[model samples]
Target: MTKQLLKPDYIFESSWEVCNKVGGIYTVLSTRAKTLQAAFPDRIFFIGPDVWRGKENPLFTEDESALRLWREHVKNEGLDVRVGRWNIPGHPISILVDFSPFYNQKNEIYTQAWLDYQVDSLHAYGDYDEASMFSYAAGKVVESFYRYYLSAQDKVIYQAHEWMTGLGALYVQKKVPEIATVFTTHATSIGRSIAGNNKPLYDYLFAYNGDQMAQELNMQSKHSIEKQTAHHVDCFTTVSEITNNECRELLDKSADVVLMNGFEDDFVPEKSDFASKRKHAREVMLRIANKLLGTQLDDDTLIIGTSGRYEFKNKGINVYLEALNRLTRDKNLKKNVLAFINVPGWVGEAREDLLERMNSDQNYTTPLKVPFITHWLHNMTHDQVLDMLKYLNMSNAADTKVKVIFVPCYLDGKDGILNESYYDLLIGMDLSVYPSYYEPWGYTPLESVAFHVPTITTDLAGFGLWVNSVTGHEGTLQDGVKVIHRTDYNYSEVADTIKDTVSDFSALSDQEITQIREHAASIAEKALWKHFIQYYYEAYDIALRNAEKRMKKQ
Candidate 1:
């Protein structure tokens, strides 16, 4: 015997990264949109903050004619919103709300939030007010739309991602009790704060009190809202098992379901053109490095990369640099490794001298003064990557076998140095490493494998843990993704293992490399949305059933 699942007639999802390209959340939502659209075409609505008011947002396409009646009704409800289509694969409907007016009413809004739900705002700081305003505005938009267009008979669902949008989910839960609400904490605030502050998160997770940590880390408001939303939503969900543990120990609740992040393979080049794409990416990347360092690196150079948010210790940029520095002393390392740190930082501008040299056809024997960095950083001495490079004595000298280049700007195809986008150049790498310490679900390593580039990640990453589970063992390069065992205390050991892995990978034959590349693609294929969407369906079912039960009680 089996039970029929309750499916929603309409779904509304809210997130800060809906149109704004900040980090991994954008990738998670944008890639997942087409799949959701296929299931419920024209019924899925994505709400985002209208941060680009009076400016051009290339990621969004606005059509004033879209949902004209609803737009009229929403404007009358005191919401300044734009109905547009997200310029992604599926081109889903998007609403960008102007949340500026809510700033003026924040005191009243905070009071209401406190009365309805115990969301503490006394200690809120930095981006807290801005994110909460947008979240509340989004909730109002959904409530107005539901009141105007939907009925109690309609199966409606609202989902909020991250703590920035938690208030919105709580708001909808109270104001529109008929609509099912879900709160997904990609990573809990206290857990991330503990990890960012260099505290051992997993070892002492159970012993640490969430409220005490919030006070110590100056994160009371954010943690308070996150904790309340997890407990109040019709369904609470998270992205990975590791983060679920954080929810249990820190937030005093567990996720009803774990919705693993899935990759959409439509972005990858076809088999007929992958080789050419890889070649072009490699040529562009090598030319930039050679022109800047005054060294010629041929196609045989082992180009490695590690990129993510510029969290020095959390994203393991420090550890990656340490491993690269240690690899210089490894006698078994036979190949010349040219590594890249593609994390964006406080970039002042592109180097005019490098641009001028790149335009020149002549070859110069002398390297630039600071040959390590691609861009001129706002704080050159204070930048962590450059500081670590100087500490490790990794200057790009003439005879240095391992040359590291720090690209401290986002590669959005317009960074003045590498005109190619991040993915456009990502295909070139011989190996990729994302040894993240605080990653929930690492998109960098997953994206690398999708491009047929063998990647090395650690067990701390959700993707790394998932890979190890699928293979039934911690794998090596032959398995396409090498999952290294990383803990809070094993920094030096992780660096040594990465150095040895890179050294060993360099010695493989051409045939072995091809097989490994194929295996990596297979791993990515298994992680596509077709397989992962079931989790989201399960979440919707739980939310709808709980909502029905609540309505029955009313």
Candidate 2:
């Protein structure tokens, strides 16, 4: 008879974004934490860098009482850490290690890594040292914890995320051979660099050598650690099938398991609450747009937005702007369109004129001077969005039916202009477009759909491809998402497609729009963690089984 697979007795997961909400990895880890916590109870622990050493981290709640014995032992070993519970649904136990002391021994760590695993860190630069030190320290924390608490009979797993945490995964693999290691790279460093640098990523994906491209793009150190970790770990995984392909080509290794990023629906409002909150969202968004543009926008105005890290070409900011330009020129448009760029940028401050208008009850009729952006940027002349607006002569004239506004500040519910979070303002948008050229697994588009806002994304995005696969038909506004076919050289065609999509969506009836919104929510429902957490289990199984096999051989 075949034996049942062994599950991990304890799991230690580490990332640069544990309690720190830096990027999509935070979303992946935070949202999925509850499910894992429910299954394993107090057996799961997350380790992250204590970057917010002195500042109050709202995401973490430290408890001096929970792990008093372990905490005191680690402190004696010269590891400064805060034992806490992550301020999320599950409140999973977390260790936020202060890795500053590891910097003093950075060279020794790198040399040992090179000697043991042949991970090349000689050409490291930028955030490499910081990330590596933190990673190494995290690995040490896991090793120490396991030695004190766990035994050889226990099934243990240590999973590390991205290149930032690769060194830690490798370190744990070397030190605590009994602990299984899993390494997941959400996006390949070399692949993203190539796409960000304006190279033909898809068309020339086959020809580019990972090492050669890494050297050319100054990404050798990151690529080396990522590649080595993938090859060396008990289980290597990535977030999506799209990124899995990139891993095979760029990292010279394929994922043992494809652990797709999932979302939790606990954050979504109830039916009645959603209706009230959505109404408030629309009112606030429209009010801000009206004040900024000096135009009286009503409920009928078609509000559209695109937001992410301001990667001009990678996030398809350029294409989005070109689409708006085309839409502005089209004579067939009927309703007034207000397109917003909510991506964060280096801003000096909120526009004082805009602030006064928002604060006052008076309805201003005249546009503010240089009113294209809601805030003044540090590099106004050279900013990509602003530069494109200038190139296209998009002056936001009173007569123009389509107007574009850039919100160049983080919408942490405290920005002086809108004073609403991204998700809050997102619910107001009639449509959200993320025509990304190099998106790995786009949370923006997925979040837009989850908010019941129909979105237009491209086939290049992992979420977009997933939508296409699920629908079994090409995406369209009627289907809740329009997945436009995008390629390395099809920038102009993509812009025109988005322009056409907006025009088409404008003509839909109220009933049709409502149906689309319902469909969008349905698509988001399939991506919930409950339905998607099985992939993570598959990864854990693979890692554990492989670790057992390796130990038997040893």
Candidate 3:
């Protein structure tokens, strides 16, 4: 017989990315917040580190009157917190805790953790201390709130995200045994380290010992906390099937549920607005490209792009450059290709010359000095993209049919160059390519398809695997996304495939391109939070049941 599912009376979710837009986790939490809020309303609370203290946080709005009694109580108890609402579609109740005070008691906390949960922190360094302090503070906040507000009869689920919050989950598990805890690892610490270190992660995943590798790589503390938390949590979860395998091999535990990342359509512009935005985006891109390259890139020019974190090897930035270089040399290329690397780097400042040209009415058909990059970088000699371009001798010359531009700054709508947000610029692209070598859950490619831009990714990406499953065949740009089969040894083959794909896409008719865009949007519609939120519910049920079982034994 199927057991009755236990629903949560109160849900407390904590993450380092709560109100902080650092990486893919921010996308996961921010997009899914509305669905959770609708289900629990005021009962759901999000706890995050108060990194924006004494500053304006665009993603959050503070309310002095919220949780006044509990705020005063926690303040008296030496806990510093700011109660506010996250400025997202859901506007859920958010508590940003000041964890700086806990740094003084770090040794005591680590010692207790090592004794109780076998989490090794002796080798910890860098951000580990700060993240742990915040985690401990988050745990204290949950403990205090639970003691004053919740009853023993209430079913509570406290979910922590990534290793940054593992210590907090462990603390919650130990102090509040009655509360169910769920820990979700987006990617294993050792797994990412192995891949980033240029090791064959997939081929040697089963052979390598996670603990041994952690010691070798000086990642013992982070790995230890992640592993111990997975084993100790009421329910251990991951974002995708790819990461579930990583967890099994590295952490020696399997996920109770796979909570796949989902997107919300609320961010997408309506039909009429989307058309106008696309037109404006194309105009801005072409205007800048023309100014920098000293060429008149017409409306027919194929505008393609790739954007993500600047992990040169892991994000396949190297492969992308090689492919673009190959495409430039391809004689069969039918259209003018204006490819962009939207990845941010340590930028010095926007090009004042380019800015002057853009601001003025005169259309100069002369290339700017250092024409390949939109902004000046702090360490131009050391930058990977510049080094690769120099090595390949890609000058973005006046006669070259294929030109590449490096946008080395964040597209936060305030960056001096584009002066538009990432998504705003994204809608203007004809096609997008990620081709990631070590992506856990590729939000870039997924976001690309969501914006009706056909994307090229790799089977190595979690989103690619999901796309293949949905299409019932290997993905292609014709079908809205191309999932190139990638292995550690097939770098050249991947580059060749990307070149051929771009060539073929450029040859397609306008009607054909529109059809492909429609297909891309359809795939994105299937991945909305409405369809994927059930996995979270399943995770919550598992945590609740496991917590009930543990409490009964206690």
Candidate 4:
């Protein structure tokens, strides 16, 4: 029989992505909030930075009536915070702290941190100060909130996400000894730096010393905070087993639990609404593609996409592009492939000529002067995507068998060109691809699968590994996912596999494709928060139990 779990009376979760949409962390927190809310109800609180102090944030809905006295109490305690509910599912109680005031005391905060935990903030640069200040302020917020609202007798757990919030977690450990703490690192700073620098990370993984690598790569401050947080917290958790190995090797501290990321699929259209929405999405996608490329693409044309942060190497944009280029030359290809690079760039604006053409609704056989992108970039010459396309000569010419378009902006329903939310368009895709090399928990591929679009991801991604584990083998496109094997030196081979997968997918019978889409949705259903939230409870259990022991010792 399994052991009984310790549950907290109150939970305080802090993340840089609480009301912000920076990357995959946003999806991780937002999608899982409903399940957390259901479990904890009014007792769970989320703390985040007040980055939008003057301006309004669409993701946040503030309610002055919710925490009426706590708002005044926090301000009187020398912290400016907004007590409200996050605008996402469940509308979880949110506290957005204005970290700007803490910048004046950054040096003092750093000194205290160094004295307490030996964190090396001396080499800080760029986002270090900002993130640290926000973390410190969040810590103060929790301290103030606890002292006023929560009692020492109440069992409380504070969970912090990523190294960006490490200082806050460490602060809570020091200032609020009565509260249990959990620190989760989505991805290690040194690991990402190592991969971003084009170093062979996995090939020489065992040979590398994390401290030495940190020093060599200018990641001393980030590594210090992350390492110290992981070591000091009551519970240290990571997202996946791959990352668990990373923690053991790099931080020299193994995670107490692997909290695999999960999502709630309520955002997905209902079965009654899915068909009409999907059809409308397809119509819009096809019309835009036809207008941009000036080619009359049939409804049978394959619409595939790869979207995430524009990390050319880490997110596998280079390999995805290479695969698309190779697909153009495949003699056995059955359908016209329209591949979209939906990663945002430094966009100048939507292409006026293309927008004008789209508005006219007139047929044009000739392509635009720049048919490869939907938006004008600030530095078109400096952009990696355009530069790579130029190198591969994968222009969307009228005669080309495969056409590539770069949607270099967030698809949040108002990009001027594709006035549709990403999910609205995501459901239209025949296939989605996220071949990330450094992914801890790949949410884009997961989101794609959740939307009933079959996705191709590499085993290096946490989502792909989970798929393999669930399916009991490497997944196939027919199984609604294709888990390609990727490594330090298998770029060319991985590209070829993607090309093959896409080619094979494009040729599948309509009934077979429908079955695959159904399969993909089923796989996604297995990954829902209802199934994976157990690990989070397990983390809470370990923290609470440990905290109880520590309290007794104190």
TM agreement with the true structure for every prediction = 0.98, 0.98, 0.98, 0.98
The window of 10 residues in a row where model 3 has the poorest summed lDDT is 357-366
lDDT of 4 by residue, 110-158 (tens): 9999999999999999999999999999999999889988898899999
- Per residue, candidate 2 scores C-alpha lDDT tens digits across 1-554 of 95565689999999999999998899999999999999999999999999999999999999999889988999899999999899999999999999999988988999999998899999999999999999999999999899888999999999999999999998888788899999999999999999989899998888889999999999999999999999999999998788888998898899998887889877677888997898899899888878877888899999999999989999999999999999988777778899999999998988898898989988878888887898899999889999999999998887788999999999998877888888888888899999999988999999999989999999999999989999998888888999999988999999999998898888889999999999999999999999888888888888998888888888
RMSD value for candidate 4: 1.2
RMSD of 1: 1.1
Per-residue lDDT of 165 in model 1: 98
2 versus 3: better lDDT goes to: 3
Cα lDDT tens digits for candidate 3, 363-414: 6778998788999999988999999999999988878888999999999888
Per-residue lDDT of 284 in model 2 = 92
- Which stretches of candidate 4 lie above 4 Å from their native place? none
* CA lDDT, candidate 3, residue 161: 97
In model 4, where is the ten-residue run with the lowest total lDDT? 67-76
Worst 10 residues of 2 by lDDT: 2-11
The local distance difference test score of model 4 is: 0.92
